[model samples]
Target: MANVAISELDKNCGKVVAEIVKLERKIFPKHESLASFFENELKKKNSGLLYLHVDGELAGYVMYSWPSSLYASITKLAVKEQWRRQGHGEVLLKAAIEKCRTRKVSCIMLHVDPLRTPALNLYKKHGFQVDCLVESYYSSDRNAYRMYLDFDSS
Candidate 1:
């Protein structure tokens, strides 16, 4: 079995942050990427990042924030293309949810592209329900689903 581990990323860890930024640029479109603002996002007291490493290499990451005491938001979730479909995304997602649980949030929410079937399935498997369709959420031509996982129902 491969050596795998997940841990909270420290905002001051420049090397890891740089690596994540590089991966973000590769995985997401320019307008959707938070690569340029990652460091600043990490500096926020209510936000944090958790990363998964496979054989000591970065495999995936999830970014989450509890801006309000009542709820949390999963801002991003990404797995390296090489690591896709190997359960890395699920592991990272579960970790992020657990982190939000620790913060005593009632629910966790996220926005996802409706066309990304794998991602939609993954979130649905974890009990995220689509609350509404967000028209042009990503762009003029793209729509998104606003999904939420309520701890109270779980």
Candidate 2:
């Protein structure tokens, strides 16, 4: 638990990609194309990818996908295992929410593993509520819990 800073992730996209791969392997252990898609879209202004730096090192990352006319989707959010419970997740999440507010987006959504109780609780604490259950959503056939947060104009 050190000084943590989050900024738009670009130069660190590759590291973020690797961290996700690490998570994937720890869980169902499969490679997917979503990581590459996010990396490519980072060069565009309408899209954003957030990274966390703590104690002067890249500790975690998160991202929101803005595709033309869709509600910005939280594509990924991962903090290295050693850095968990240090509040970096909440920091990145608030950053993402603020990013949406700045863009005038009214709703933000994300998908989380239904079995990850801690993560589900974390999102709930931040005002994200379950929207739906995406059954067999991943290559590993793991269920995904879709969550949404509505931003108020006032």
| lDDT scores of the candidates, listed in order | 0.95, 0.73
lDDT of 2 at 113: 86
Q: Write the per-residue lDDT of candidate 1 for residues 1-154, one digit (tens) a residue.
A: 9999998998467988998999999999999999989898999999999998999999989999999999999999999999999999999999999999999999999999999999999999999999999999999999999999999999
Could you say which candidate leads in lDDT? 1
Pairs clashing in candidate 2?
Answer: none
Cα error of candidate 1 at position 71, Å: 0.7
Runs of candidate 2 with Cα error greater than 4 angstroms are: 10-28, 32-38, 68-70
Error of 1 at 99 (Å): 0.4
What TM-score goes with each of the models?
Answer: 0.98, 0.80
C-alpha positional error of residue 40 in candidate 2 after TM-score superposition, expressed in Å = 1.5
- Alpha-carbon runs more than 4 Å astray in model 1: none
Question: How high a TM-score does candidate 1 get?
Answer: 0.98
